[model samples]
Target: MPTLSAADVRAALLAGAEIALIDVREEDPYAHGHPLWATNFPLSKLELEAWTRIPRRNTTIAIYGEALGEDLAPRAAAVLAALGYTRVHRLEGGLAGWQAAGGECFIDVNVPSKAFGELVDATRRTPSLSAQEVKQLIDTRADIVIVDARRFDEYRTMSIPTATSVPGAELVLRVRELAPDPATRVIVNCAGRTRSIIGTQSLINAGLPNPVAALRNGTIGWTLAGQTLDHGASRRFPEHVDAERREAARQAARGLARRAGVARIALHDLRTLESDDRTLYRFDVRTPDEYAAGHLPGFASAPGGQLVQETDHHAPVRGARIVLADDDGVRADMSASWLAQMGWDVSVVEPVDARERGERGQPAARAPQPAESPTVSVATLAEWLGVKAAEGDAANGLAEGHASRAGAGARDTRDTRDTRDTQDARAREVAREDVDENAAQRADEARREPLAERSARSDDASADVAVIDVTASANYVQRHIPGAWYAVRAQLRDALTRIPRARRYVLTCGSGQLAAFAAADLRGLVPDGASVYVLDGGTLAWLAAGLPVEDGETRLASPRIDRYRRPYEGTGNAAEAMQAYLDWEFGLVEQLRLDGTHRFEVL
Candidate 1:
């Protein structure tokens, strides 16, 4: 396999060339450290996710893995090559070589977003308050409305006692409704820092009347200060904003977006941008429920706040063009402004005509198909296995028939009748046993244990069980069971090897659908002695039951190989992680210093 030097990769990024620096390790390992622009593509999920992630087969893909002992990059390169990925290469010395060459190594996933947040703070000196100071205000009953900038689920997990969930993107548009009085102080927070900073700055950028600030260092700082956080909180901003307020927000956001150099393009220009031979990501920056009601064709639902937070996950191609759309211009304009400052080639388009709207559930695009596919349909593979089994059974039956015929020739008619009856009775017994065994297998495959039952089992001294949360990293971080381990369904086979040995496995997702699929996959991979069950109704059911939930990434039965941690996510992030992240962000200004490729201009 061909190899690319770390310096060469840096040069490509600097030159604005299209390249994918993929870290082919599990999420947890990948999160420990990687290049600033590197995207995680675990070797175990290469076959399942590579095509979709790296859609262009001919695109340059540089694979890297653990620097110390084993090298999974070479093997990963082979897999990509087999999949018809034409331009695959291994990073010359792996991640260590990159560090040796003075290339930045950042901890956590979504390095781009986190680094950008740090950069924004460094450049703009975004205002903030210490967790202790904010807590004191709450105790004094200050006129403040804390807006949690994270997702609703995250807010539900842990939030300030009186905070309301407004998310990041919605902060600007809805702040007027949340706090109409100019004297009311508005504070934004996230699990850690990035969203809090971004959300706070967003309101400031839009020139909101109220005094706005970030909860310094976010929930992590709060925990460090020994502040108690509310758990399972459900307070949220109103679903509907008045038209007059919406118009005012649109004007404010548009001005800010324009000042930030976010291009306002038409549909025709979008068509031209799409034809430029560069990657383009179109998203509707609205709530999922609103998006489900209606959205432009070819646009995926990516609520503006989450999109900014998880830009890498949504559009891994750093140099790609991102076009955001919304029925109301406020959301997209504000979102585009932040994305532009984060170094994305971002634009906002006017909402499409109602006739141009697509169905609610359609995806932005289909997953890419592998070049030289070696996969067969499940039905076909099952038929093939059945045929092979039947062939063996037929041979055994023939041998038995021959033996019976030979014996029959030497026996009387009455004796032959007895032999025939005995054989018939034995066949019936075997058939009944087969039926019973099949029923048992089916029951095992379809079993769904309720959360209460699973919790009880875990509490039991003798029960041997493992609980796996197969949701995305962001979701798992927001809230999950006390002892659940996070894993991606596509990489479950490899994850299972790392998970503790157990007689039974319980799988759960946001809802039970993905968990059900994962459970079936686990059953096929595990030994017959091992059983798998899906959580009935998944984590939502757990919440409904008012069971306690844990926050932050914890108890990894499998390595946190499913998602990357944002520098701002979780509590007690290492000092090294924070400094390394800032260093990488500082380097980006210089890294993009020479790259004429990014058309970014900060207001």
Candidate 2:
């Protein structure tokens, strides 16, 4: 019941304390970097199934997650104790404390998939170069391409001279697209930090050819260094546009929409349709919290990922068009991008011009002029931003929809009511069959186990057991223990099919590594009262212990990569995005370094 410090945990490690170090971060973050000798049981997943993974019922369970430096440590400790972990203890101060105390975090690059991700980040390293350095590099004609990695509008507002707009996140994927010449030296920059630093690191990790770095401190740095920023750039439409700006962007967007053959609807159309309830799905593709606070009264929020992931589920009207709302042009554009790609007859239903606030009263600031001999057209930029905004919008929309759907009106009620009823009926039937079948199967499995071994794992956890076998399809079909079925990590969603209505579920993976990931993913799908678990050793250990082995080919094939494509699909020039992303990333690193708060761990 005592709290454990990183130092205390270190002592435990040295003394060989029989404790499992659990990372409570999301699966992707865990895959990126985590404590050595620690197993991942994402906190989200652990809340529901702690008993399944930590069934010792007596050993101390230690939990840690991201470096927000808050009370998650104690909170997790409390949750564990409540779950009957008995002597649950918090890792004092979490991973940050562990790192500060010279503890090691581990990164395994052996797995090609995970290694690829790290490489993408590492290869795109863009350290922030001082303004003097940038000026010096440019003056000397040192083969560098200066990229303004902020929004194109931001670039137009005020940016370093000769800088092109390349946003973050797109950095890794769009590098070559921006600077086609492999030998070009790339300088990425943003208004400030975080995005720039992450962007730069992402490219370096991905292994870009050119030497990349950021403009230290970004545009602020440039101005502070007595370097002039260009104010003659064209404006990118604002999220909440004023009358003048709104008119400008509207006119511009109208022209573009006409070119794309898309019809634009006003807010009146939105309101008129809202009351009709005619299977029309209105989406606000903004951030999750934004969608939650308040949205157009009739809209069902569907952030980008979920919107796209369950496109057919959320909006079955393949032919039915969608109206998008966003204060910022970014969300609308990004969400539209994805919806367009998903074959939705989608268009940015720009907010009514009456609600628009033009930039008339705002102080005159530096804005980018339309390029005289421009390499990229405004129309091209609009298309790019529009698409990205749509995708981003969809993501934000999906996050909001997820949060709101818990309380919102039944979406697709007409179709879902029958499906829900059928599923419920099917669940009851399945439970009845499972009870009888599992009872007989349990008897047979009981016969294989040594008396003592059976008792060791068979505490109440196994009685009303729900087994989720997280492995390749081939592995599961070949010879999973009787009821164990496949829960592919990537398509882990499909695992919902096998879930029993009346039992606690326990997930198993190849080496216990993926078991934790699966359990975390499947946590949401478990029935209202059922608990979930992960087999400590997975199939490897089960087989190592001489358990039965079955072999059948799995249906698993690398799923079509097409689904992973964003809706507002564009073949983003990764270099440009990488540059923009690095601009923010390096800026963040510099700030963190200057503030003396960034904690880096040697893995």
Candidate 3:
């Protein structure tokens, strides 16, 4: 019930005050701007149902929002207090206070970069690489991997020949898949400074393998350095998508729309659908961040990944026709392909091409048009979709346990009985549709993760476990589980500074998935008697479990012990050492031959 000023919160954060910063605002408002460290848990959802997202009950939580004056903040505090969570406090002046204090806010479709930036600043190390140096290295065909840390569309526009497209948010999830070999030097970049700077920092902060650094100044710097840009289109896509391919993908989407039973409404049909009695499931398959930034009036977000991951969760209108909106045909077309493959009743809502029908008032066609069916009765279709939605809800644990149990037999036994009673006569004709590559991509990512990582988890880990904090110096210093030792997976050898590998280690991360991977990788690297285990659900889960956490960047003791900086044991390559540092800084060391320089093959 007490309130803390912005300065108070800032001081706590800066001094390593372990606390959960909660932004109690609407999703849209939270998306626009929230404190750098805050995680959104809208008060509206808490009004309807308790939130399961926040990490812990006993955590020292600081809640803030512009709407705090509108009773939302107090109510949120009450909910937490009633839930037996002690130490829930409100921000004295809400976001206004934080912003007034010169604090920063962040916005992104996925993992907000502002939070990642804060982590980077905490370590006193900047993620950077010389543009000229990386280009020169690439010219030699050395063992270097360049990654374009921008959206796919951005990559399509322009990128280095050696770079591959990997969006900033997806970097943590997909980095290992792209570069499995630890010896390969990794370089990340974006169009300008912020993303490239922050993206590289995130991976480093997360303790990923491969000596990683950001291409300073990104594509602009590379271009200034006079490097050639490859449009990446020739990297794959066929030169021309023939009529046959387009028709097949279109038909596939149509068939899916038909089977799903969503009315294949055209863009101009919005008025009619709004007036109809039946419920509608309108979707926009663009990025969630884009949707949050701005979207069509009637549509809800069904970003490609979430749509495929939870089709039944979003669209329950089995056999009902669906309406979709996309900026260009690419995303919609890509999504349509997947829905078509899944047997949804779908159709492309083509825009009225202004060129074909002049703007002011176009004349009607001379030929008589066939009258469409008067609202094809979808009452039965609606019911079928509802049943499917209900089933999906149960599968995802969104439904009540009691309701799920009761619906179990109803699905199987009743489905069989209903099938015997109905069937062939009711079979709806599904128009062929095209497949959405986005959907396929989503499906591929969804299918990639094993079941063990996807299931609901608990935080009651074993006691006195050796928890290795597998995060960069910045992330470790920002906030982490108390007593967890830090290890930079990028600098594994250097990580062996203060901590010995002889102890039993439980790797901990923001999410347990990456930590699990690290644990597996470290299995053979540690001493013979030492053992490693993953902290189930990582540090986030640990926080949610009401466990203790502390702040301050985990860093190697100052006065960096330069044990390996002595004269090169195998090859006296002082020139190589100086050259490697210069190339790393300026971006063209490989071209300058290492004459009488240190040469140590990392492999």
TM-score of each: 0.68, 0.27, 0.31
Q: What range of 10 consecutive residues in model 2 has the weakest lDDT sum?
A: 406-415
State the C-alpha lDDT per candidate: 0.68, 0.47, 0.47
* Model 3: lDDT to the true structure: 0.47
Which ten contiguous residues of candidate 1 have the minimum total lDDT?
409-418
Write candidate 3's Cα lDDT for 352-465 as tens digits.
Answer: 333322222111111212122111111221221121122222222211221222222222111211111112111110100122445434432332232223222244232223
What digit string (tens of lDDT, one per residue) describes model 2 on residues 1-603?
A: 476887766565445344566765544455455554455554433443354334345665677775333444555676666566676777776777877776655432112112221222344443668889998887787777776555444465577777666555334434555555668878887664434544464445445667778676666666556677776464321233345533433343344334434445776665554332222456765444456565665454454423432343344322345677655443454434434532356666666442342222212111112112112222222222121111223233322322222111111111121122223333334434444554435533443333334345534333455455554343355345434555444344544654445465665644444456455556676677766655554544444333333335332322221112211112232444435443533343333233232122211
Best candidate according to TM-score: 1
Better of 1 and 3 by TM-score: 1
Put down candidate 1 lDDT per residue, 194-299, tens digits, no spaces.
8998999899888898899999877766766778888768898987787888888999999988877789888766788864357778888888777878778778
User: What is the RMSD of candidate 2?
Assistant: 27.6
Model 1 ranges off by over 4 Å: 82-84, 362-365, 368-602
Q: Which ten residues in a row have the lowest lDDT in candidate 3?
A: 424-433
Candidate rank order under lDDT: 1, 3, 2
Query: Which candidate comes out best when scored by lDDT?
Result: 1
